[model samples]
Target: MIKQLPISVSGSRKYDVRSQFAALCYRIRKNKIQILLITSRGTRRWIVPKGWPMHGLTPAQTAAQEAWEEAGVRGQSDGRCLGIYSYSKETDENGHFPCLGMIFAVEVSSIADEYPEAGERERRWVSRKKAAKMVDEPELARILLDFDPRRPI
Candidate 1:
């Protein structure tokens, strides 16, 4: 788990960060683990399916919804957070703000041919190590590389 720290967003402003939920979708095949990644809408960087919190759903449930919308995949979420990773989110109004992303493990059970963002994003499944390397965020990459379901985050 990543420790919380005060981050400066703009001049004379510092605060503890909040986080969005992310689905770390994975599947076990032939004794190997494969992780699903999707291209970001703007920069096209590879990332796990993530989104802002939604009302009436828990964080892990929200992560599952994001997975289905962004990647056309659905699965069982253990309702446990795998880890947290800090990254900078660029915004037109805020310029850039530090955001923590809480990742929840989703064991993928199905993949559809079409999803809400099907036309806007491309999804791929790769080995965990390759998925780790493909993403630009160091903390996210580290989470993927050191994933252990048996251990508490």
Candidate 2:
């Protein structure tokens, strides 16, 4: 099993059988991050290019897969993982799927003209300032705020 770092918020913490997913938020031309805002078939508000892992791939590799699956963008994600954030979901009203996400810096030379999964969801290459305003999550916003294209990871 992969070791997960314990997360704490206002004196609460979590861990279990399922795991936190890792993903990359890609930057297309001119250091703009590609962000997707939408719901799962299960319906939850989130901003991510994410999914569960397949056996042979590492979390980072799985992140790359999710990027392609969710965003229809292809590129090299050789940047180092910067950090993690969490969000919660539920299949049923009372139960929840609390998830943590590791954010990585990714680069794309090109984006596909169409995304297979873009239905009802909005996708864009947003400037860091615009991205910060688009999301409610402070953590995701911080990632965009601290995003310096000229700096090497």
Best by lDDT: 1
Off by over 4 Å in 1: 1-17, 148-153
| Model 1: per-residue Cα lDDT over 6-43, one tens digit each | 22234332233357889999998887889999999989
Error (Å) of candidate 1 at residue 27 is: 0.6
What TM-score should be assigned to candidate 1?
0.84
Q: What is the lDDT of residue 79 in candidate 1?
A: 79
Q: Taking the tens digit of each residue's C-alpha lDDT, what string does model 2 give over 96-120? A: 7766677765565566657777664
| TM-score of model number 2 | 0.70
Q: In terms of TM-score, which candidate is strongest?
A: 1
Q: What are the clash counts of all predictions, listed in order?
A: 0, 0
Candidate 2 ranges beyond 4 A from true positions: 1-18, 28-46, 92-94
